[model samples]
Target: MAGTNRILVIVTSVGEYEKAGYRTGLWLGELTHFYDVAEQAGFAMTIASIAGGHVPLDPESLAHDVLADLGTDKRYADREFMDKLTDTVPVADVDVEDFDAIYLTGGHGVMFDFHQSAALESLIARFHETGRIVSAVCHGPCGLLDVTLSGGEPLVRGKDVTGFSWPEEELARRADVVPYSLQDRLKQLGASYSTAEKPFATYVVEDGLLITGQNPGSAKAVAEAVVGRLR
Candidate 1:
């Protein structure tokens, strides 16, 4: 309760899965899980997107199997929560000083744009340099891929992190269309990337101020860890 009590929830604005001839966007459960947890802890959230406007939902993420235990049934039925995705604040328009932390929510769509936004990179770098928490879940870590700190090094360099792993990508049957391997990119950047023993199992890593979750199953834990950091 002593912190700023603010959180910026970043989502993917890209919905085109042209490679797979389909569309993908934010994984609803990823956002819902983290949003629910942090909100309960009294954190006010601002949902943002790379380019803003509307955030498409990964159609597969809404499957009953994925949403069954995510506690999102109520959110899916709540227009207030669902409407936040319809018109998200663009990252460039955000006031960096308004938040204490930044959370990147994932879906395959992020693979296309998370690393492409200079504004997002700058905002993340500002958060990192100021000692504010920079966290991501699943493919959301993609946002950190290109962010470089004032010291002239990639923010992820030499840090312990995790996201949707390569094997998990294969398991999710998305290895073919995800643009690039998040696990590989993390390792390529010198991050000590890790994952749960089994794909999709909840896993979170906290290396200093950088927090990351392995998959959607890890979203709640990631947010809890962020809440703990704020406390």
Candidate 2:
């Protein structure tokens, strides 16, 4: 990839799930795994959030078991990498033309804020209309809920896609806490949604320039799919 190949990473700024009384933000592995893969592929990357400044991390995502399984301990300890989370560009300030791709990384926090940001929806729409790749993993697809194209059609309508599944949410015991089931919302928006029979498995789908991952475990696969398209 050339130096001009740039990617914009969208993370949730919602620090806590107010209704559930739990601290939540971006899932650490979701961002780190995707970032590591894209960066190593030679794409310059920028981190941005719904709200600028420090981004919260879902505490559970940093738990020992999760970190060990994801094999991201070194990234977790990277001071420079971790610093990027401390401050992020506000979505409103992002120039959609500068990025070749827009990646939405997820955590439960996204369920609350991602889908509600008009600025993000506009950015995604522009990226889509301009022939850039639009990708998301886990609850990050929540951001796609209301994006409308230039023709006023819902972006996900009639598109084959996948995201955090309803069964996965219920399995994680967050079904009631999350604002809504992401899979259900995607289906309601006319996206053809599907996922692995097993929760948290690596499952990625690409429909045109749109790429999506089923869960955090699918982050790298999703990034690779984007890289494949870009190449």
Candidate 3:
């Protein structure tokens, strides 16, 4: 407790596409990668979903090729980490005061549920208004779209932020299936959203206490930025 930072990680509960077969929950690497980086820096983490209970991973994020790219397999293999995902705290049950920051992880599934939850939006607002770090990576920023501060201004209004971009979504082939363009929606909400020049390149933007990363490739960097800020 003396030198530790408690991070509240908000993951999505809905693993949609059940009808079509495959499911999409939080992107595994987005959470695992960030977890590895932050935990290594001595930060404590709590994984939670809007509806609580288990939260799955986007199947593709753990594919052989992806596992070859990200250092997430270890987290997947670690029983302690997997256990956390197996049973997560519901967002409504979380007390903003217990943590120093809130990190929203991403997946296509988040496109279905993250933005719609009023409870999550309220916590995001509370985290920001209290001068705590509010961060997200990839589709994670979707949760920030509807959050309004106690002052009544959109949390991201005029904020320089970056999230999963239209080009990246199109490249991932989920452009047609996704509910809306995360980049476009954030811009419409008055966020000055931008992206990396390369579709999947790592990109992160830190504006005041709100930090956002461009895609899965940027998760660890975003976590590192949060670590630096917390210090």
* Cα-based TM-score, every candidate: 0.97, 0.97, 0.96
Off by over 4 Å in 3: 18-22
Q: Per-residue alpha-carbon lDDT of model 3 for 44-163, expressed as tens digits?
A: 999899899999788888797787666777777789768888888999999999999999999988887889999999999999989999999999999998898888889999999999
Which portions of model 1 miss their true places by more than 4 Å?
Answer: 2-4
Local error of candidate 1 at residue 222 (angstroms):
0.3
Clashing pairs in 2: none
Error of 3 at 84 (Å): 0.8
Better of 1 and 3 by lDDT: 1
lDDT per model vs. reference: 0.91, 0.91, 0.89
Predicted candidate 2 versus true structure: per-residue lDDT over 1-231, tens digit per residue: 455699999999998886778888889999988887888888899999999999999999999888876567778888998999998999999998789999999999998889899999999999999999999999999999999998989999999999999889998898788777888888888999999888888999999999999999999999899888888
Lowest-scoring 10 consecutive residues by lDDT in candidate 2? 68-77
Model 1 over residues 1-231: C-alpha lDDT tens digits?
543489999999888785878778899999999988898888899999988899999988888877776688789889988998889999999987999999999999999998999999999999999989999999999999999999899999999999999998998887887788999999999999888898889999999999999998899999999999999
